[model samples]
Every structure is written in C-alpha cells, then in structure tokens.
Target: MSADLWKPSAEIKTLQQRAAILRTIREFFCDRDVMEVETPSLSAASVTDVHLASFNTTFVGPGHAGGLPLYLQTSPEFAMKRLLAAGSGAIFQLCKAFRNEEAGKHHNPEFTMLEWYRPGFNEFTLMDEVDELMQLILAVQPAERLTYQQAFQQALGIDPLTASLESLQQLAIQQGFADIAEYETHRDTLLQLLFCMKVEPKIGQNKPCFVYHFPASQAALASICEHDQRVAGRFELYYQNMELANGFNELTNAKEQAKRFNEDNAHRKANNLKEVPMDTRLIAALEHGLGQCAGVALGIDRLVMLATRKETIKEVIAFDVGRA
Candidate 1:
C-alpha cells in the first residue's frame, strides 16, 4: 500500500468549511423559494458541446440484449429543463457532474456543480440574482457588468465583432502566442485565444465581474440577441481573475436548439472527436415549451476553494482524483 493512501485530501477544518458553505447555499435558495432537486447522474446521452468531454460506460442488465452505452452527465441542465417543462418552478440542484480528462487545480473528473433556473427571468435580471448569491457566499462586492465587446476593446484594443482575422492573428503573435499560426483562419478560435491570453488575465482583479453579450457563435444554450443578431445573451462571472459561473438567457425554440446540437456534433466530427448522440428527450421538452428563463452553472469545488482561502481545488475537496 502507498504511504498516506487512506488520508483525505482536505483537512477537517476545510471539510467543516465546505459543509457550512453548502448549508448556506441551501438556506439562500430556501429563503427565495427555490426548491432543491435531484436528477440521475447517468444518461442515455450527454452534452455535445465541443468544449466539453463526457465520460461513457457500458450498461449491461436484463433489459438489454447486449451492453448499452451510458454517459455520465456533464451538467444537469438538460434534466432540469425537462423538470421546468413539466411545470416545476424555480429549481436548483447541487450534485456531481463528470467529464473526461478534466482533473486539475480547478477541475476534477467528478466534481460538484450548483445549477439553477429562474423562470420569467432574463439574463440581466438573473445577473442581479447572481450578484446577490455571490455576496451571500463569498462576502464579495457588487459585480460590475461588462459586455464582450467592451471587454475585448478595453483589454486588447480591438472590437471583437469587427476585428479582422489578420489583426487577431497579428495581435496574438505580438502577445508572444506561438500557437497563433496553428489556429489558422478560424475567427472564433483566434478570438478565444486572444481573450484567454490577453483579456482574461485582467478580469475580476479586485471585485467580481460579469462578462455578457458573447458573440453569437459562442452561444451554447443561450438565446441570440434579438436587436443585435451578432451577440448571444450569455454571461460569465469571474472572481479575482478566476472564472466562477456561467449564465444564459436560455434558448427556448426546439428547432433552433436541435440545429445547434447537430452543428456541435458536426463540428466534433470535423475535428476528429467522437460525436455524441443527440439528446432527443431534451428536444422534446423544448418542443413542449421550456418557457423563458435564465440559468447558470457554477463550479462548487472552485467556490469552496475561494471560500476556504485555499490555493487549489484539491485543498477543499474531500479527496483528490488520485486518492479516489
């Protein structure tokens, strides 16, 4: 046996802090009438977002002629939406989400996620709620709201919507990004690189920040801005230069949502990644009317790291992946 194999990664004090934090989170939602919920961790299908990788396993039982593939849910968004479609109002779930190849300082193959949806709330109103939630949890000041356009312009001196591909590549090179050439001519990829290398480092330096109005191409589950079709109604919260939460004015149209899922799988195939099966049930829920709402997913482990003043997520989690 390896030495110290039985010891947990987190100290008793850190674990106590975690317990207290979870308690406060529950109280916060309870005070607001948000019902706590639970959903299955395994699913017949998983998220097809190119940025995420889902874990898969074979399910063999009496119901199957052979083993059937099941995916570990990357987030509870789909199931929670189904609940909303079934008329469950304002619900929150504090549960585990699993992803492949995702263990690090702020990530684990299996990690806690706190997700909620507020019916009749748009992204802006939900942002205010997020501000309140952050203050309640982290003792943080009111978060400043900034647009994607403004963040890009202020940090990198380029308008993200209108910046030329050549300019993006040139600026990335100037910032000492050696991999700029590898990104080639994909505008979105170059924009992402620029944002990561340049703008992201300067965000949420002192107080919290909410960056919204993302480019339409980056709209994962968010609705497009009706007035400005170039942008999506999504927001991401950052704290002390670390990303903390992502919220969206959710897309409600079934046809559009289906198209996006297919597009995501197509993109995955084009990049030589495995294409995930489409989540037909979620689409059915959308077709049945998911309603207008805003939802967000926050990384609970990362929040615990901040609340406990720990340097890495491993310090706050009960067990690290290796130990688990």
Candidate 2:
C-alpha cells in the first residue's frame, strides 16, 4: 500500500472553503424559510431511472429470519416526496447520495447532494430560486433561459421535438457517433448523447443557463406541460458547461406516476438490466394527495468545484471514492 493512501483527496484549504459554502447554502435556505430535513440513506426501493445505477447491500439483522436487501439511495427524492405528501412545507436536505459505476472528473460514487422541494411553486418559479442560489454561490449573473427545442436548434440546427428516430440516427452518425445505430430505437438516448457531446460544452460558458421545457418523453418525474403536450415542465441549471441542478414541476397524480414507473421497468427489461422494485409507498403517498410542488437536486461537490475554480471533483471533496 502506498503511504499517500492515508492523505485526503482534497487540500485542507479546499475542505475549509467547501465547509464555508455549505454553511452559506444553509443560510440561503433559512432566509427563504425552507426547513432543513433529513432522510435515510438506505431504502427498500430505488429509482427506476434507466440512466442511473444504485448500490445495494443486505441487512442480516431484521424482524425476520431471512436477510433483507436494501439499496443506498441515489437521491433523497422519494423520501422527501413522502414528506411533502405528509404536508411538510418547503423542505430541503443536505445529504449523502450514492450511485454505482460513477467516478470521474465530475462524478464520485458517494457525494453530497442539496435537494429541496417547494409547494405551490412551478418550474419557472423554482428556477428563479435556483438562479439566485447560483448567483450567490458562484457569483454568476442571472441565468438565461432556453427551451430544449431552442437549445437543439441553436446547437445542431435540428428541432429535437419533431425529429424522427431515423433522422436523429443519421445526424448522430454525421456527428461521428456511428455506433448510435445499435440503439436506433432509443430516441432519448440519441438526443442525450448529442446534447452531452455537442451542446453541453458549448453553452453555459459565459453565464449560467437554464434549459427548460424538455421533451415529455424525457421528463423523468416531472409533469407534462399543460400548454405544450410535447414538452414537460422540467428545467436544468448549467454553469461553465457543468450541469449544476435538475428541477421539475412535480407530478402528483398517482396513476401517472405509476405508469411512468412501469414504463421505466419495461425499458429496463428490454435493455436486459435488472428491474428495480418501484416505490409503492411513494405512490400511496401520492394517492393520499401531494399537492402542486416543485423539487430540485443540486450537486454540492460540483458547486464547490466551480466556486473554487477546481478542475475535478476530487479537489473539492475531502476524500473521493478512490481515497475512500
């Protein structure tokens, strides 16, 4: 073993700055009267999002004889939503989130997440709050808003909402992604690859940018826009070409939420990945009634990287997954 293995991944000074920024985040929410709350890092169910992977462990001691399986939450979104359904007004959580197969310049398997939910707030209103926090933390100007369609049109000269799968495949090939032919049926996958490779690094370089009105098919947990059926009321905040936050005008309908979860499982099966158990408790909470609300999950380590002008997440985190 190397002697340097005992050293922290981040410098002492950087950790200090990271702590100060966390304190600032608390103050920001406190000023807005958002109550800070906590949730368990482990749960019986995990997100069914195909793009994300969860870490699992077995609990040997339980009320029963058999070992119980549980997953380390990728985010506190589900538990927090349960709180919202129980009538917790304007709550936020600064917690540790875990994901498998994620470790890079921008990603760590275990990282800090700042997530909050605001009842009676739409995607637009919640975006303004996110912008305010970004401005205060990164000292950036007010974010410029752009629809998903506009972003694609401006970056690749194609309308993402109307483009056919065949056309997107051809475009991806032209853009040197010839392997995209293997997943020709996955329209969202092609769009995401194009956006990350071609669009993301270009925007949010000059100022923070708010990309909203994503295609309804890619809405994740957000609600479909009332006026535009083709799009959803979801938004993401990006700064210096780094995605800082993802927010949504939350979906409160139990049936729709269940439908999405089933659809996700179907996709996972088609892709030959393990089908995760859906959060029936969350659905029950929705059935009991979760009113209009908006929620966001922001990456704390990434924010610290931007604030300190660091190149990688390791420079901001006290000990990244490698050191841990």
Candidate 3:
C-alpha cells in the first residue's frame, strides 16, 4: 500500500473530538473515585466465545527457554475480574484490545475498549449509572431505558425470548436479510441477524437507550435471572441505533462458569476450530469469592463514532487494519 494511504485526512476533526470525549470519560470516572488500572494485554488464555477469534503469538522466557504461547486479550475482563476477586475497589481501564478475523468499517483487529466494574451493584443499578455517565459524556439530558424484549417488540413486533428459531429466520427473510436462513439451527445467530438488520436501526432513535434482560442462552458471562430462568441479568447500551456497550450482573458461581466455558469449547470442537485453554485461575478466583458486582465493556471506537457522527470506524481511529 502507498504511504499516503496510511495517513488520515487533515479534515478529520472528529478524531480530536473523540480524544476530548475520552478525556471527559476519564475525568468523570476520576471524579467518582474510580481508580484507573492497567492489566496485561497478552495472557495464557483467551475468551472462550466461539464467535470471537483471538490472535495468538509466542513469548520467549528467560535463559532462552522454549517459547510460551500467548494470546492477545479480546477484552480485559478476566484479569480485571481476578482483581475484583482479590478485593479491588471500583476500577476502570482504557486500553487497546485485539480480535482476529475482524475488519470492516466498524471493526478492526486492534481496537480500544473502556471497561469498568462496580462492587455491590446489580445490572439495574449499573444501568442507571451508565445512563448518567452517557449524559455526562454527551452533555445531554437523561437517556431512556428499554428492555431487550421491548426493543424487539417495538421493532419487529415479536418477542425475542419466546420466538422460535424458525420464526426469527422468517422474520429476517421477510425483512430482506435472506442469508439468515443459513443459521436456522443456531437460534442465537438468527436472533443476532434479526437484531442487527431490523431491530438495532430503530433503537435509541431519540437518545441513548439501555436494553436489558437478554435471553439466557446469549449471556456470554452474565448470571441468569433468578426469577426468570430463561433470561439473564445482562444489558447493552445503544445510541442512534449503534450498540456501544455490554454490561452484566456478574455470575460469581465458579461451577456454573466452568460449565459455560466448557460448553463454549465444546462448540469450538464441534465446529473444528482450535480449542482454547480454559482459565482455571479465573475459576479459582471465583471460587475464592468475588463480591457482588456488576461490570461493563464499552466499545470506545463506537462511542467515538457517535460523538463525531462519523459513518465508519476508520475515520475516527488513528490507523485501522487496512492501513496497518
């Protein structure tokens, strides 16, 4: 590629606006007494989510010992949670994260993530805090809160939790996403397609929206709702129909967490993908006890996009994958 291709346009003032917004985020957190923390970007284990591919590399040890395999973290979640288990108080981190096989207008192999955790908080409490944080960051009034089911009902006239896989696929086809039929056997995949194609574009139409109470099957790391076994204590934030963050009332049960991780690996095996090692250390931390807490991971790039009203992530990022 030409060197000129890597340079950003001089008129990209949105980049400067993004930087200012990020500074405001840190200021907000610091004022709230949340300590900024740093964690390793490379780890012995990566997230088990089959859909998120992780980039792997090797590290040399002292005395020229054999290289040890390491994976770039998809998020700072595991290590941060370990710190929480070790009794760290309200903390936040802003860092670059990596994910393999992602490149697009809204995606890059390397991207920024802003993650935070609050002790003694549930999903609802954290949702309120996120709403307030958005107001502060965007310098706007309070945002709206809508449950996941309500968002789906408003957009597609169907319930996400109770809808069958076939019904979701049909809805996708009817809505002009004919490719969704290929994932008929995977309910989660079909639901995601429906949401992305039909539902997301309608969310947060007037302001930021907090969509909570996700289906239990799609809870990547959240705890299942005790009152409703079919749903999980998870939520996602959206603005102008763009997803910005995902939060959860963390599941502190080690056994259940292990089960979920193993199931993810099993799915990987079934799909002939390489099996990733489980983070036994994280499970141990959970067993040792993590205080009642809620955590969230927000896409900094998406936030920058919204703050600048940029159409593509490349416009806001310093350098995207195609240039790098």
Best by TM-score: 2
| Tens digits of per-residue lDDT for model 1, 1-324 | 799978999999999999999999999999999999999999998998988999999889988769889999999999999999999999999999998988787788999999999999999999999899899889989998899999998998889999888888888888888576446777888888888768988888788899999999998799999999999999999887578999999999999999999999998998889999999999999999988999999989988888888988788888889889
Assess every candidate by TM-score: 0.97, 0.99, 0.94
The residue pairs that clash in candidate 3, if any, are: none
Better of 2 and 3 by lDDT: 2
Candidate 3 lDDT over residue span 171-210, tens digit each: 8788887764745578888888787777888878788888
Error of 3 at 10 (Å): 7.1
lDDT of 2 by residue, 56-94 (tens): 998887584587889999999999999999989999999
lDDT to native, each model: 0.91, 0.93, 0.87
Pairwise lDDT winner, candidates 1 and 2: 2
Q: Top lDDT: which candidate number?
A: 2
Instruction: Estimate candidate 1's RMSD in Å.
Output: 1.1
lDDT of 2: 0.93
In what order do the candidates fall by TM-score, top score first?
2, 1, 3
